[model samples]
Target: MWPTVSPQSRSSPSADGAAILRLEQLTRTFAVGDQFVRALDGVDLQVAAGEYISLMGPSGSGKSTLLNILGLLDRPTSGEYWLAGEQTSTMSDDRLADTRQREIGFVFQFFHLIHRMTAVENVELPMMLAGVPPAERRARAREVLQRMGLEARINHRSSQLSGGERQRVAIARAVVMQPKILLADEPTGNLDSVSGGEVIRIVEALHEEGLTLIVVTHDQALGSRAHRRLLMRDGRIVQDVSG
Candidate 1:
């Protein structure tokens, strides 16, 4: 069984009974040779704050494309993306970058920690980039790393840590900013069962604390854990189920 995490250890709930994300007639296309490939076909979605959702589909299903758009890493070829009640389509590049940094946290299958940086340093990068003072960012990094059960390894570089520890550090970095939404793409795809389970529990604990969680995965068991499940096919949301 997974250990329960105290709410006080994590960021406070930010849900205010509103939709945190909304997409209308969203479409993304890529030019392939002489043809346009539609990655997202008129997709429409509304995600309430604090909701836990899982997106599942086959390889060509546009899960990654949609995740990219939601993360603000990519823009839809057509349609509007409203985040926290603001239409992001018209935002300037700087504004979009700021919004992405402030409102979204992402965890990927591969731990993206810098090999030369210590756990704390890796966790501090985002805050540092955002012009946070050294003292404050260091304190925040240490706190989140401690919560990740990496206090002893905080000074260890990514190269010196195990896969699980590295991933934990990545997670610490992702959440240190206390983003409103956590977007995870195959978060456990690279870990062993034990480590993966630990990662899952950690994220679930964060969700319990009211951070909106959206995960994209091919694993049925993992995808089923969410309160809401979405199935995508041919760049469209074919099914949405809630229980």
Candidate 2:
């Protein structure tokens, strides 16, 4: 069963009512053997605070490229990306790193916990990197782990935990910093049906608690769960629908 998160325990949506992220004529191109290939072409998107969205497309359709740019992991070839009303394209590398660390969290298809680290340690890693005090980091790590229903496994190494447990730890780690935007890429691709269902429920719960959730997935069922769905093809968004 999924754990229930109290509203008080979650971060509230942006109070001033601004779009959390916006992309204006975004484009990304990579040189493959002296030939430029456009991965994203003139993409425009606006994500409001607390919106739940899904990006779906076939292979090489630019889904990953778009996500990377949104997460501040990649830069657009020639376009503007605004985050929290700030133009990110002009920010220095340090500013981008700080913004990415503070505003966005990510979960990938493969659980990326260090095998030698305990669940709590994995969760504490981010806070530690940000120079958080040791006591606060430990407390916050345990708190989020407990929320993920992994209290008992908090001290266990990643290698000692089951797939579901490890994924839960990863989720705990991702949100431990309380990022406003959570980007998930094939979050359930590595899990069985039961584990995947549980993971889905957990992320949905976070979305309900006011995190801006954006998911990139191939599963139609998973993609359909978003309130807004985007379909991409040939380096451009072909369809966008909201219900």
**Tens digit per residue, CA lDDT, model 2, 85-129:** 999988999999999888888998898999999999999999998
Worst 10 residues of 2 by lDDT: 1-10
- What TM-score, computed on C-alpha atoms, does each candidate reach? 0.93, 0.93
Candidate 1 lDDT over residue span 27-93, tens digit each:
9999999999999999999988778899999998999999999999999999999998999999999
Model 1 lowest lDDT segment of ten: 1-10
Candidate 2 — which pairs collide?
A: none
* lDDT, residue 147, model 1: 86
lDDT of each: 0.89, 0.89
Instruction: Give the Å shift of residue 25 in candidate 2.
Output: 0.5
Cα-based lDDT at residue 216, candidate 1? 95
Error of 2 at 39 (Å): 0.3
**TM-score of candidate 2 against the unseen true structure:** 0.93
Task: Supply candidate 1's per-residue lDDT for 233.
Answer: 99
* RMSD (Cα, Å) of model 1: 4.1
